[model samples]
Target: MTETLVVDASIAVKWVVEEEGTPLALGLRHGRRFAAPELLIVECANILWKKVQRGEVSREEAKMAASLLERSDIELFGMRGLLAKATVLATDIGHPAYDCMYVCLAMSRNCRFVTADERLVRVLHQKAPREIANLCVTLEQLSAGSD
Candidate 1:
């Protein structure tokens, strides 16, 4: 069976940048189904913008990266129905609603939400402690599975 996962912008950015977890994120793109909330595109773009501002990447490079991501096959789901659940989860976990949107989608789809956010990972394990906790997986965990 194939693996399907909800990935956040943290992971998405790694696809374009040669960051610490880039290899694991790249490994995830190999024959795996990736899904994200429509917000991911904006989040990714914002990340690229920051990189450009910090002079880590050129404006042209950021544009090229954004274009590549937009053209990628990652299925984008609308945020219409996910807002309420995300809000509730965010309040419950003391995390931002934006991050919870991906969690909600992962729960709704019954697949892991893979992320590179260490703080979110810590919160999920420490505070979530139940269904929400179960829905999230760190990049390390997913990468470890292939070994």
Candidate 2:
């Protein structure tokens, strides 16, 4: 069976930006069936908005980025039941509630959680990589077939 990948906004954001591991993010998008918590849309839009405000991206670029994200084939997991699981995950991982949502979804779905947030990965790795199991991977790692 094909592996399912749960993508976080940090990794998804690289799909549009010319970042270091953008190719890896894009490759994953094309190579696997992707899923994410519904909060991903909000997070992605907020990131684009923040980039626009910071002058890192133009208004038009932000719109395009938003559209691109909407058009991707990723399946969005609903927030139902996820909140409680996320809360527990947050406490266990010492990550913020919102960040833990991605981890929770990945665990619930039995899929890998792919991210571009190095700090989050480090925390998961340091605290209890086995707790998260084989469910966490960085965009660079995913691109390199480490996922």
Candidate 3:
């Protein structure tokens, strides 16, 4: 099976912005298929909204970013079973339920969990009693080898 990656909104946001980690996140598209819960759409929208509010992007730019995300090839997971698993993962990991949702989906689907949230990485490393079998890589890690 082609490798799958569970991408959180923090990293996805970099796909649109030419930030420090943008290239790393964008490079992920080359080797693996990307997946996320439908919640991703809302989360991404919220990021764009914040950028708009901060005057970093114009309203039109925000709309364009939303459109790009909607049209991306990343798969969206919405099954009830997946959500239940996510809830359990949230409890086990002691992270926000929403954050754990991505981790759960990745584990369930045998995929990597990709994010740009440094705090999440630290917490996962500290709290997950056992090593998570799948990769949980940050955008920096993804782009590291190239540079």
Candidate 4:
């Protein structure tokens, strides 16, 4: 059976938007089960908004990206129960609470949180490697089969 992976917005955004490492993120979808907090759509939309504002993608392209993302097969999980733990993780890791929602979900699922957020991966390895190194894997690392 394919292992379930927790994906954050950084990785999910790459799925619908053309970006560096997008191929890696797209490839990760094949034969793998992806799970994310319910806020994934909201985060993705915000990213698309930013892209539009920066003139990186037209409004129509952003809409298409949103439509594609909405149709994707990722399993969504609620973030309510994750709040306290996510907050603790955010505080402990010096990362934002919103991002911690993904990490906390990964912890509960006992799976790797695959992300394209290099800074999050670096921070996790730097601040709490022993505790979280196994919990998070960068998209590049996963694509290289190093995770």
Tell me the whole-model lDDT of each prediction, alpha carbons only.
0.89, 0.84, 0.78, 0.89
Q: What does candidate 3's lDDT look like per residue over 48-97, in tens digits?
A: 99999999989998888889888888899884667776676668777788
lDDT of 2 by residue, 1-147 (tens): 888888888888888866677776778766479899999999999999999999999999999989998998889989888999778777877889898888889888988888888888878887755858468888777777774
Question: lDDT per residue, candidate 1, 1-147, as tens digits?
Answer: 888899999998899877789988998899889999999999999999999999999999999989989988889999999999999988988999999999999988888899988789789778885877877888998789821
What's the best-to-worst order under TM-score? 4, 1, 2, 3
Which ranges of candidate 1 are over 4 A from the true structure? Answer: none
- Backbone clash count for every predicted candidate, in the order shown: 0, 0, 0, 0
Can you write out model 4's per-residue Cα lDDT over 1-147, one digit (the tens) per residue?
899999988888898899999989989988899999998989999999999999999999999999988998889999999999988888888889898899889888888899888899888888764766678888989999986
Answer with 1 or 3, whichever has the higher lDDT: 1
The whole-model C-alpha lDDT of candidate 4 against the native structure comes to 0.89
Higher-scoring candidate on TM-score, 1 or 2: 1
Report the CA-based lDDT of candidate 2 relative to the real structure.
0.84
Q: How much is 51 displaced in model 3, in angstroms? A: 0.5
Model 2 residue 60 CA deviation (Å) reads 0.8
